[model samples]
Target: MIRQTGATLTGSREKVLQAAAEMIAEDMGTNLSVRAVAARAGVSTGSLRFHFPTQRELREAVLRRIYGRLVSDDPILDRSVPPRDRLVSCLRQVLAPAGVGAEARRTWTRAYEAFLVPEPTEQVRDAYLAYEREGLRRMEYWLTVLADEGALPRGDHTRAVHFLRTVLNGLSLERAMPADDQILKTETETLFTAVDAVLGPATT
Candidate 1:
């Protein structure tokens, strides 16, 4: 058995996840070696490998952890909030640029990029599919709640969800590029305006 070092031996699974997340955020998509992660976490390589034997396993764990942080358990699907407003909030949270700090942005960018890569392994593929499905499910949930509350002008929840997901994905890619603040703001506003034109305005 691999011996854990320092206080990590007593640390929960969440601690391992935090260490991995910090590493990914700091490094972006580069140098995600098990040895590196072990060193960063103050644990033996064997211990890290014992917990996650394969690279894919560790990547999937990190993906799930980040998803959990991004997606709320009690999502604001309340019918009281107009569907458009709810959708905007959801998209903004999903696509907001990493942040002011280089580390924060780099971490988020790495995590997001990892999710986009098409892994050949069956387990990796399954995990990716699960992530995609969960995203769609969230969109569907928002659309359904809004439709029920008479927020959507037309209630094709499935179609609306699909369209919104596509748009969000496209916008996310665009926002990932290096652009001036004014250009970024204009592009984001234009995209949101287009979405609003289709989805209708959010009522205060």
Candidate 2:
């Protein structure tokens, strides 16, 4: 559902998105300002608005890039692994401890924060809905694949995915903030147990 916003875009439209991505890469600042993105794109703020039509759309582009980097290297996309393992790998991608997956977990937290911030533009509001919808779609798709392969049972996958995602979002926020190892581990266990409850055992 999060198709490339760049696809089928016009000249200035694509340029603006590229510019926004670069600006975000240079600095994913707390402001997430449209004026800054428009400036970097070398377009007038009006032109940027014409192309994106809203701060939310521009923010969506930027948010997309932020998450793109984090999930790009996920083990779920690794074709060599079996389907069941790959599914578990996707779950673990978020629940990862303070080691190899720590950076990604941090990025996930940032992405969620980006989502939480209010947007003045209605276009941005719609874009935020799109973001949430696409996320849910992909999560459900993962569950569908496992169920088709007889690794997971068929049920209300949407609700199940929602439960898992809600838990992950909570974990992301808590992990992103300063917290004791004990608290993080408690939540981490909660996350794992919740996932296991949804999908059953990873081995099965």
Candidate 3:
């Protein structure tokens, strides 16, 4: 009976996690809630509570799961690609979601309205901070790997990570706004400049 109970618990936990991930991907997690996730998972609230115990725990678990998925397919780990190229590719990947034309504008509009325009509530602020911290952590990891491989000079990469993030943020916004083909041309130039600034101008 105990073994069966354990299996049931594990199954419910997996279902809850998967449901949360799907919600997050679908609507940027705007409607995430224990009740919503429980419904989506086809599990009782008691099961979600049993596995997650707290909302914070559930949120963190979902974020970690999302990042884990990204890490599994991350180009930063592709050693055959030169570090500079890999970094540039990673930056482009970050901007890729902004898309172009109507899709990019819609993404930008939703993001601005959600977290920018009016003052964000405490929960909104916390969610944004969580995502920002995760982004910084990912940037640090990429730079650390390059440094360990002698592709980058060893040093504190905090500023470099922040700089890269800032550049990407600006580029992401730019991608959504109206611009000529020159914006497309300059986007690559901008990425290279940011990468070179961080990695010191790619080895010959």
Candidate 4:
């Protein structure tokens, strides 16, 4: 009986975290009080506090959950596919919306906006730095995979990673805007051309 009760408690905590993540993603700077999260999760504020004692703790938890989801669902690290295809898949995943929901867009926009801000707690800055490092690491991994498959040259993989990261960052910023299809197409093509110059032919 005690074990079953504990399981239920765990599930409730998860619900709170999920609710907080959805809310934070929608509005990073928006008020995410314990009461607000508890209300959204259909739990009492006391229960939410039991799971996350402070607002900062709850916000950090939400950010960690978001990062975990990104890592798990990332298409770039798939090893079964050809390197070029895997790279393309990874690029597309980053460029395209993760989902078609308004909540998803809001969450993504909020996260991006947070990263842009320079004034935040040390913890927040560290979290942003961690995210940036992970991005670079992923780029390096992709470059190594491509080189192993003879898709890219076997020299200076780090430089290639840096270039790709720069291009990706620029593309991401541009795509985040409320642009039309033609503009998106043109920007994407321009980015692709630059990528091809560094990585060789992107086509298989």
Which one wins on lDDT? Answer: 3
Q: Whose TM-score is greatest here? A: 3
Question: How many clashes in candidate 4?
Answer: 1
lDDT scores of the candidates, listed in order? 0.63, 0.63, 0.81, 0.67
Candidate 2 error regions (>4 Å): 1-14, 22-39, 43-63, 79-85, 95-130, 153-156, 176-178, 182-188
> Per TM-score, what order, best first?
3, 2, 4, 1
RMSD of each: 6.5, 7.0, 2.6, 6.0
Which digits, one per residue and each the tens of the lDDT, describe model 2 over residues 102-198? 5646675555455555454554456556557656766787777777766677877878988878877676656656666586558657755776787
- Cα error of candidate 3 at position 28, Å: 3.0
Q: In terms of TM-score, which candidate is stronger, 1 or 3?
A: 3
Residue pairs with colliding backbones in model 3 are: none
Per-residue lDDT of model 4, residues 95-168, tens digit only? 56543234345646767677656467765666566556666766676677777767777767777777777876
Candidate 2: the clashing residue pairs are 56-124
CA RMSD (A), model 1: 6.5
Stronger candidate by TM-score (2 vs 4): 2
lDDT per residue (tens digit) for residues 49-115 in model 3: 9888887678778887787665557888889988998888877776776787678889888777667
Better of 1 and 4 by TM-score: 4
Ranking by lDDT: 3, 4, 2, 1
* C-alpha positional error of residue 174 in candidate 3 after TM-score superposition, expressed in Å: 0.4
- lDDT digits (tens) for residues 73-162 of candidate 1: 434565466555556676676655444335445644666565556445564455456456667776677666655666665455667677
